[model samples]
Target chain A: MTSVFLLQWQRFRRAPLMVLSFLALTIVFVMVMAGSNPGNSMTVPTYAHPALAEQQQDEWLEQLNKSEGLQFELVEEQEARQAVLDGDTGMALQLMEDDYRLLIVADDPNRFEVESYINRTYAEELRIRQLEQQSTSGEARERVAEMLEEPALTVETQSLEGEQESFVYDGQLQMLFGMALFFSIYTIMFSLMKIVEEKKFGTWNRLILSPLDKWQVYMGHLLYSFTIGYVQIVLVLVLFKYLFNFDVGDQFGLLLLITAVYTFSIVALSMLVMGLVQSPQQLQAVVPIVATGMAMIGGAFWPIELVTNNMLLAISKVLPITYGLDALKSVAIHGRGLTELMEPIAVMLLIGVVCMGIGINLMERKR
Target chain B: MLETEELTKVFKSKAAVDGVSLYLDKGESVGLLGPNGAGKSTTISMISTLSKPTTGDVRLDGRSVVKDPGKMRKVLGVVPQEIALYEDLSAYENLQFFGRIYGLSGSRLEQAIQQALELVGLKERQKEIVKTYSGGMQRRINIAAAMMHEPELIIMDEPTVGIDPQSRSHILEMVRQLNKEKGLTVLYTSHYMEEVERLCDRVYIMDHGTIIASGTKDELKSILSGEETIWIELDRPYPELFAELAAHPEIVQAAETEKGIKLIIPKGKRILGSIFQSAERHQAQILNVNVQTPTLEDVFLHLTGRKLRD
Candidate 1:
């Protein structure tokens, strides 16, 4: 067993691509999917209406551009509304009956920002006009200006000690975790691919011919698979924590433990795949199907709540990742502890044992 | 120190290795001679404990290892016919791994790896990955991997199946060095007659999953004592006339060839006159003819009435 483990380690080091693919691809996933969208900046379009006074239009244009949080352009009236409906832009501002109205679709991430900006800008313009008409004296105008400057109601935000529902599109944590789980499939396939290479290279016969116990051979590979998957998950997690300053909540230790177990189960499951398939081509065909299907059902790609089918959701409950996500979400987001979440850890371990047992057992029988 | 008694294996209704008994004394080189599918590998497999015998037992140092194959594995270094190595790993890494599993440790394991690499003349390039190696280099490393433990007996199964002649000679020389200079025992198997003739003191000829003959090379060849072989390359096929020559009293054996036939005749016999007469009658012109002393190939022919390659 020691020999097998050492050999596998040496082999892994020699094939730098194998190690780098996991880290490199995961980093890309982090950058593309989990990148911080610090507060949004958007641009919208409207039309140059012929009926509006030129000076008022210029004043409104200057204010809207400065405060839209994003840049906008002037298009024809129909084109402006159509762009919003066609999903070209999230929202658009239109001038109507001595006021302004914002056009939007049913779903948009920038709905609140657009609506508030439009209302505040138009209300301030109307207030200034009303005050100027009533007070012509300089002293009265100064008093009215001071009164209008004060806010009607002050709103301050304070977060309580509880799970916070996500109101922003910061997918960094979810993307990071999803990629880590998805890569366990690669670890599994590569692990089995090494076995196939052994058979082709004829080293498998030497192993069989050796006096070493069969478990040592299987266990060595099993451990290597775990190590590879575990290392990749850790690297990605650490990046998210230190580089992005992303919140992994307080239970870092418990989160690490569950992830390690999750990786073990995934590696063992891959070993099962290796035991069943005889060639690299078979591995390529089978692994993608199995891993993608599992990730999809396990909520690694998108949240399971996004899935509307009851039958599909019910099936996903049996998958190992559902428990992994549940356990991970509890510890990383909800601040749960090991004692409070015993069942998921136990279930992950159970899956690992069953998978590793059957996989190694089949290989031993083959020998 | 190894022996098999009536060992057998049955795959479904067919027997791959039938009842056969063979033995190897200490510090002796023995050859298992047979064509393909003659159960040489199957017998080796059972002896190596990679497969179990259906009946009988393999005894190591006068002890049966049917139920458990332990003690013998410690003292035996096996070189499978296949390369049997990790190509992605460097040669040194491969040797170290094999040596460690064989129970060597620390500096002792290091020494064994170095010695094995040097034995195969691959120490200088040991750091390079095996995938970068030529076929012969890989074969040498394969042999080196087996020798890491310095086992009492080294069992090689057709170690030179498809290799350039230069590497083939190098491997043969390495085996000779291990067996003769080091006093290591060897159990070598091959289909090539010349390899066995040049290497082993004793030989076993196998056919149809059983040993037909086993003796010293000279002793086995003595089965067709005072025999001379005739090579007849004809212009065309001569089945009818060849049949006549086969039925003659002096012709010991006759096997057909693509162009003509090969005849094994008794020594000091004047059978060429009758052969030429038969060929003339068949209207087949003899392109070439040569007579030589009996070889292991001829002995195989005399015993089975078929070519060794057949």
Candidate 2:
């Protein structure tokens, strides 16, 4: 195993550009995902009524006019609505129920400040209206303010295993996991192409003719590819964590375990590629096409929700990347604990086993 | 000792190597001689356990290689016809990698690499990348890479192909040294008759995936006993002269060359007279005439009815 690891390290060291490329791409992905909008599902508005349009406009204009430092722009209602929908505006004001209705759009799920600000402003307006109607004293308004400032109730969710939802790296973990899965496929294809090139160059024949068993040769190549995949994941995770503050979640041990398993599965897949391909160019073309296609359908670049239910989903479930993504999202986005991810872990292990069996059989047949 | 019995290799429906049997003594250097696609490589591949024979058995030291290939693989060093080497790696690194794969390590592996490099006369340039080396140097290193394990039997398949004359001579010398000094048995394969004649103690001539002939140099030459090969050098001659020479009853075979004509004839006094009469009738001037002994090329040509090059 040490020999295999050393050989793998050597191969990785020889191809530093690949390592750098994977890391760079993962950083880019992490940044993109971290900065991206979580869409309309997570956005919460301050008010829900649809009437009182002119009253809200007059109030917003007065507030903007009194502001000394901030720039203000008042466009037509339709344009403002379009801007909010297009993720161009953060919030839009409209009239409803003889009061101001603030339409707050959160481009990021973590932007709770804007939503809270809108909610507090509406609460203050409601309190002022009540004081004017009932002649409440200043002290009573202060008390009302104190009551309104109390923290919201928090609800904790857990998986079926009774473990708390631990996935909490702010979605960076999920993005990193997805990108790592994407690059694992690429690494496996690259390694298989290298094998085919070695065979074309006749180096494989020499190695086989040596005193080493066929298993050793196969292991050496697998080790090299495994290390490549492992290092790629590690570098991407590190870069995202340090450079972009992209969270990989707090479950470091579990993340590493999943990465290692994913590496093994990719390496096994690479061996199978080597077995199936007869030429270097063929391996280059076939492995990437198959791997990238699998990744696309397996939810590497996008969520599996894009594919919905179909044969692709069924096939994607069998791929290690699908399980990796599920586990990663659980740990990173939903704050799921290790005990909650046994299913994805098991799926990944099953993929590794199946791929390795096929790969080994193919290698033996190659002989 | 290395031996193969009734070895056969079939690819799809084509038999690349038909049923063949041969043996080598503990220190003997045997050669497999044949033209391209004669199954020499296929035979060696099976012997080295790089490929399995469709039906056959290979034995090293009376132990079945087919039954226990691991044991045979440990004792056999194979230099394939293609230069099987990592061009991106330095010669030393390539040797070290192969040595490690063969389970050689530390001081033993270092010593083996040094000795192999010395044997091939590439010790000084071992640190240079193989791709940077000359074709001959690369070929020598390819052989050295195989020798790192110091196996008892070395199987070299067409090691001299595409090599320069100097490198070819160097490789042949190394083979001889390894066999004579180290007592290493060799199964050398090539189509070049001269290389086989110079290096092999015994030879097997394969054609169309089967051993057509097998014998020592003297035994193979004896097949054409009592027949003398005559060469007549002419400055310039009419095209009809060859026809005239070919029509002679005494001459068994005649071929024209740029400088001369070569003829094979039976051991009879009438052949020289008949050749002279034919040359005179064609008005050809013979500058030099010499009678020579038959070479392996002659034997191949006689058996196959085609020139060795053809």
Candidate 3:
């Protein structure tokens, strides 16, 4: 087993381009896509309407800039319009006395985020102004703000299971985890392709004729694939977390554990695919399809929360990537501990064992 | 030291190897000669314990290995027909891994790799990746990988199927040394007649999954001892003259070869004069003529009515 495992590493060293390319791709994709929305924040250019006073626009800007996830910059109306027209920004916010309008230009994925932020800020500031108008004294808005800060009646929303219901979306960590897991599929499946090549070329028979057991031979290849995939995910996560300063929360250890389980599950899934295919060329065609399809259905390209179809959500429950992404987000975004992540970890492990058992059985039966 | 008893393998109701029984003594190089799809590779697979025979047993040292292949596998080294080494790795790396697979380690594994490389005449190029090597060099590394463990018996399945003559000769010489000097029991299979004729001490000629003949090279050639082969080299194919020669009572069998018509005639026959007369009458040009003693090729043609490489 050691010999076979070590052999794969030696072979990988000689032809490390495929695996390294995947690692580089994961980094590059995350750096470009997730890096564009660091800290889930975007800078929106704000300009006051010609009828609005400068003092009122400054107050609106102050309220809008209070949001940690959005930066509202005050600029001249002409300059803001020019920026939007020139495609320097996706959209610009025009401040009015009682309302605001978004001057749209090019389409942006983060456009909704900017709109939601401005809408909430405008509503709150307008309500406060209305409250100030109805008061005999002019301190009514300040008193309302103080009361809102510490509400007399607080509503704590929870699921029927008594768990807190809150959705925290960090675009950076989502891209980091999604692309890391997605590209690791390519790395794992392609590495496992060595088994199909060995069988096709008859090197497998040489190992069989040796003193080593058949399980040892399989374990050698499986272990190598698992290690490569695990390392790629961990390395990408660490690089983004430290180098790029992407927030993965404080549960680095849990993320590592999740990564290990996810890597194992993917390795086993790759083995099952290997058993179903006849040749390496067939595997080469199938790997990308499986990876891309799983990424699409399991929410590697987007958060599972965004997928509304019940059928797709049901299918995602069976896919290991669903659990992988869910568990990773739970740790990185929700700050969940290992105890809360037991469900996903257990599901991933179960999937790994079942797929590995079926895969090895199918392969051995073919033999 | 090893034998298979009535080894039969069936695939989807078609018997690939039907009741093939052959044996190898200690330090003997045996050849299994057959055309493609004659079930030679299948038989080797069963004996090497890489596959299970449908209805037979393979025994090593008087123990049935059909149920327990570990005993047979322990002493077996198989050089498959395909180039089986990892192409991306160097020859040294492939040999080192094969050695470790057989439980060799430390200095022993290194020594075994160097020894195998030297035996295959590839020691100087051991550090180069196998994919960068020529087909012949890749094949040499293929054999060297199998030799890494220094097994008691080595089974080679067409190790020189497609290679340059020089590399083929090199492999043949290496196998000869391994058998003669190292006393490694060898079971070599090929469709090429000369390779088997020159290397094997005993030859088994198979056709359609059955062993048609098995004896020493000289003993097998004696099957055609009463006949001699006439090589009539012509300028081109003369179908009419070939038909005339084939119809003659003195010629037992006349087949068109690449060169010209080859006639199997009874010994001490004086049919050359008549052959020339027929050729002249047909306006055929005879480039050359030579009569030679029978070889394994003739024996195979006599038994199966087909060439060894057909």
Give the B-chain TM-score of model 2: 0.89
Predicted candidate 1 versus true structure: per-residue lDDT over A1-367, tens digit per residue? 8778777877777776866887888788767766543223356787655677767677788767886245657778888878888887777777653587677776786778677777787787677667677776746546766776896766766558455444332255567677777876687568657776776666776776677876777677777778877888888888878887767777777888988889887887777777787677888899889888988988887777678899989888667787887777767766778997899888878887888788767655655
Root-mean-square deviation of every model: 6.7, 6.7, 3.0
Poorest stretch of ten by lDDT in candidate 3 chain A? A159-168
Candidate DockQ values, in order, are: 0.51, 0.51, 0.84
lDDT value, residue A26 of candidate 3: 97
Report the C-alpha lDDT of model 3 over B4-48, residue by residue, as the tens digit. 999999999999999999999999999999999899999999999
Candidate 1 C-alpha RMSD relative to the actual structure: 6.7
Q: Residue-wise lDDT of candidate 3 within A166-249, one digit each (tens)?
A: 667787888898999999999999999999999998899888888888999999999999999999999999898899788899
Q: Number of clashes in every candidate structure?
A: 3, 9, 0
Model 3 misses residue A25 by how many Å?
1.3
Which pairs clash in model 1? A42-A70, A43-A71, A202-B84
lDDT tens digits, residue span A131-215, model 2: 8678746476666667768846646677786755432333345456777788767765675466677677788887676665667
Identify the runs in model 2 with alpha carbons over 4 angstroms from their true place.
A1-8, A32-175, B228-292
Assess each prediction's global lDDT (C-alpha) against the native: 0.80, 0.75, 0.90
Which candidate achieves the best DockQ against the true structure? 3
